[model samples]
Target: MNEINNILYITGAGVSEESGIPTFRGKDGFWKIGSKNYTPQEMATRRMYKENPEQFLSWYYKRFAAYRNHGPNKVHHWLANKNLITQNIDGLDGKAGNQNYIAIHGRLDQMTLFHTQGDNVATQQAPWDSVDETSLTESLLEVFKISLSTRKPMKSQSFKPYVLLFDEYYTELYRISEAQQRMIDADKIIFMGTSFSVNITQMALEIAVTQNKPIEVVDPYPVRIPYENTTYHRMKASEYIERAD
Candidate 1:
């Protein structure tokens, strides 16, 4: 039997595609909101969030709603025991009871205070959860109005979804140093459901290639595998995991 002790599994949006959640980058990903000129990328930035909190909240809330009902699939369950690193923010891995994983991108279920000073604080859940979405929106708007009326900027701001924006640095919250070390230490590396489009994926791939580690790539679509010791499986994440087991 092949020893899977030093295995490292790096996953992306493709892992959760089998579930109801949609990928947020490709053709199947979040495009533009209705009648909005800005793309999802533009909306999901610190600048946009600061300039127009209402619009930012609207888009973010929609994203949270979309991924709320979906649970982890076979891939997540199988990889729960493996050393996994995920770029997804849906939190399905956590829901599946997979603790041996790192979420490079922050999860949606968490909230953070929009502190004016340095370092925004993160909370397990939203500060005010008793109110429904509509009521929440209205309350935020009222707070904004109050701030404007009293000319007190402090009253306007509250919490924002704890997700990594496009412009944000991964090292801010993610265990990037630890993740990179894991990539370098892995004897066998597996790439699943990723397109090799993100920076972190590229970094991991380069590490594996430079060290001549054996690699297995699982994706239904054609993905670029630059390493010589790589075996590509043109299958979905769940199918590949099941077959390998």
Candidate 2:
């Protein structure tokens, strides 16, 4: 019998591309297609949320909420039973039934108290559960406790999307410590569909390099990492999973 290695799968937007979601850096990726008035970097920040709550929430709702009904794809199902830390916030991993996977970037389908990072606050299902697409904007404003007239977040009643913004650092809210420990403990680390643009990927790569763990990258056009033990598989995530099966 082949010994099962404790492999850790770290995924990114590419994993969900097959599920009809765009990658953050792809030609049609979310970050690449920011709002008309602002760049994604500007729109997806804590500053935007605080200063221009309406525009921030409107942009978020239009881009992210549209994919709320998308189901998990083959890659998500394949990684469902494996140890995984995903940077995608689509919640497809959870939809695929991966009960314990860590969403290092946070989830779009959830919400938390509108507090700063490191605050130990509980999360709940996003208000989208109760509102349809047409009413999402008003519902969002209501749930986040933003005053409809003043367009400012109300204290204590405000909730934010459970996503990590560009201006924010990793904290307990996103399970950063747990993800680091998993990177250390895994015998092998598999990076799927990520462009190596995010800090989480860099953090995992550093851990893998320091521990001398084997690294495998799966992407149609994989980025070249300056690591000795890293292997690159130039294939789409679904194709890679099919070959593995």
Candidate 1 TM-score, true structure as reference: 0.85
**lDDT comparing candidate 1 with the true structure:** 0.73
**What's the distance in Å from true for residue 46, model 1?**
1.2
* TM-score against truth, every candidate: 0.85, 0.95
Can you give the lDDT of residue 97 in candidate 1?
A: 82
Collision pairs in model 2: none
Which candidate comes out best when scored by TM-score? 2
Q: Give me the overall lDDT of model 2.
A: 0.89
Candidate 2's residue-wise lDDT over 1-245, tens digit each? 55648999999999999899988987888988888799999999989998888789889988897799999998899999999999999999999999999999899899887886787898898877665557766776876778889887754578888899999999998999999999999999999999999999999999999989899999989999999899999999899888899
Instruction: Quote the lDDT for 222 in model 2.
Output: 93
> What number of clashing residue pairs does each candidate have, in the order they appear?
0, 0
Least accurate 10 contiguous residues by lDDT in model 1:
147-156
